[model samples]
Target: MSKVPRVGIGVIIKMGRKVLLLKRKGAHGEGTWAFFGGHLKFNESLEEGAKREVEEETGVLIKNIRAATFTNDIFPKEKKHYITLFVIADFAGGTLPIKEPQYVEKLEWFMWGKFPKPLFTPVANLIKKGFNPFKV
Candidate 1:
């Protein structure tokens, strides 16, 4: 476990009344649903990190990206701490294919009120705070 909190970016791709979600596979939040994102690479801007993660994980391009909110996700069991930055983005293009199958089990679109069970910790924390990405 690192001494400092790692930075992560989460992109909430909204289309109509639904948002994209992915079932995690081999990472820290395995078996839980999360947005299309991952760790911010060295020297990458937040927007760049979000775009890269979305494309790398879901083979999708996103646009109109803006900072949404954030959550302090600490998993003692996993010995991981991440300051997750949430960004709201619109689906610009690309097919919804699971590019990184090793990290993601599947992808799906869901309404905010009808999210799948077992959400990733950061997302759950956001929800607990009543942070609605749809609300402007």
Candidate 2:
């Protein structure tokens, strides 16, 4: 079988002391809480993809992105995906609708210790490590 490569972007958005979390819908981690992100489009750079996804999924424009985490998940029986994750801060943009309806079922800000359970694996891993959702 031939191998296929996939690239994805994830962003950590912060508002003061709280971090934003989105509830995903109809995708790999559907119904799970996660950061704002999505797959990269053709010829798009990682940073570009991340910026676009953050806005598309959360309606937030990320101003500062620091390279902090990288994850590669490979499935021998399926496909391999390379993910570029960033810790974003100091953003300025319009307030997102209470809910994004299609991509996200809900959007909420939570303090690390107070975040809800069952976050998508990647985000959960970060939170578990006490990774400052804001700091890179």
Candidate 3:
């Protein structure tokens, strides 16, 4: 049987003109910049999962969470598929720290239209579709 697609939530915490991004350093999407996020926990709502992921990964609290867009991410080489929900939110509080060094290399703020390359597949796909969280 083929593996099923997992559900994920990507949080874009906006601070004025910039959004938070992290360089991934794990099995999937290594060397690519991505928004803070992770797999959704069972029975967790999308908003809850987004908040949890952002806080867990970057130690940043977010609020005013809203659904921005989504993408169907399929990594055939990795044998992984995911339906990722993209959320736009405001940075509420908390210090930004590299909480999970195992999965992330570094965190930085990038202007919306000036993102660094190479971006994670899902984020790149979203950008290609003209999905702008800031405009939502």
Candidate 4:
């Protein structure tokens, strides 16, 4: 494992009381539910990274993007660590997320208190921290 940890950005796109979740297949959090996001590219602003990731992964757009919360995640089994920055935004409009057959099993909307089981560890950590994306 590298001595340095990576930085990941997760975009929490909230619509009404729902949030978007992608079922991961062949990634670190395989077989778990996670937000649509990836690592922050070099020299990219947080907001830029968030917008870029969402578009790249889902081909969807968002508006009123804003910083939300973060989590410090460590996965000993995978021998990885990440400083997870989360941002909340509203779905702007465009093509909805693709199923991403290669890695994503499904793209689904879930109510705030009705997240699917076996959440990605990072996302589960957020809930453990008492995170409520709907908070002002």
Candidate 5:
């Protein structure tokens, strides 16, 4: 294992007044709601990673990308740590599909303050920091 903490890119894709969130499974935050994202690759800028991840995983194209916030997420039981850069992007256009069925159970958009319960660690952490994507 790379002993160093892994860097993750979490994209908060928004449309209208709702934010896109996916139900995670077979991972640390299993069954929890979170944004679409993945590990950041070498030599990639934050915006680059944010755009690539969303397009690759959820088949969603985003534009007007902005740096929203970040979270230091550590899973003690799994012995894993990731410093996730959470970025906000408006939903440009796409036909949503459950591309990675193994990891994603489903996807849905929710209002700002009415997000579903049991969010993935990083997202929950963001709320604690008071970062609002809609207002950004």
Candidate 6:
């Protein structure tokens, strides 16, 4: 079997001590609440892809992105896997999109200790580890 490495990006944007979250609409981790992000395209660097995704999905421009955390999702029994890089950044754009394709059901900031349970797997673990990218 061959192992596939997928590069993705997530942001931890804080507003007055609150973090942003979006409810997934479709695809992996659908129906769960997670950070705003997506897969990296062929010609894009991780940071570039991260910035693009964050803006495209939320219409929010991320500035001063800092490495946060790395996560590995491996389902050996089922031969499924994913490696994700999480980055923390500051949100500096107008209000978020309230539509499909980018169909984030809801957007809200929440206190760290009061975040909801059953968060998207990668995100939940990253948050649990305190968002340190190089740790992985």
In terms of lDDT, the best-performing candidate is: 1
Q: In candidate 1, what are the lDDT values of residues 1-136, reduced to their tens digit?
A: 7899999898999988899999999988999999988899999999999988987887788899999999999999999999999999998888988888999999999999699989999989989989887897
- Global CA lDDT of candidate 6, please? 0.71
Q: Candidate 3, after superposition: displacement of residue 61 in Å?
A: 1.1
Off by over 4 Å in 3: none
Question: What are the per-residue Cα lDDT tens digits for candidate 4 across 29-98?
Answer: 8999999888999999989998988887777789998998899889998999999999998988777757
Ranked by lDDT from best down, the candidates are 1, 3, 5, 4, 6, 2
In order, candidate lDDTs are 0.90, 0.68, 0.88, 0.88, 0.88, 0.71
Q: Considering summed lDDT, which 10 consecutive residues are worst modelled in model 5?
A: 51-60
Q: In angstroms, give how far residue 89 of model 1 lies from its true place.
A: 0.2
lDDT of 5 at 131: 87
TM-score against native, each model: 0.96, 0.78, 0.95, 0.94, 0.93, 0.81
TM-score, prediction 1: 0.96
Model 6 lDDT tens row, 1-40: 2467666677777665677888887666777788877787
lDDT of 5 by residue, 25-97 (tens): 8777999999999999999999999988777777788999888778988888788889999888999998789
Clashes (N, CA, C under 3 Å) per candidate: 0, 0, 0, 0, 0, 3
- Shift of residue 31 alpha carbon in model 5, Å: 0.4
Superposed model 1: Cα runs more than 4 Å off: none
Q: Which runs of model 5 end up more than 4 angstroms from their true locations?
A: 1-3
lDDT of 3 by residue, 1-136 (tens): 1478988788888999899999999759999999988999999988999988887887788899998889999888888899999999998888978888999999899998699999999999889999877787
Clashing pairs in 2: none
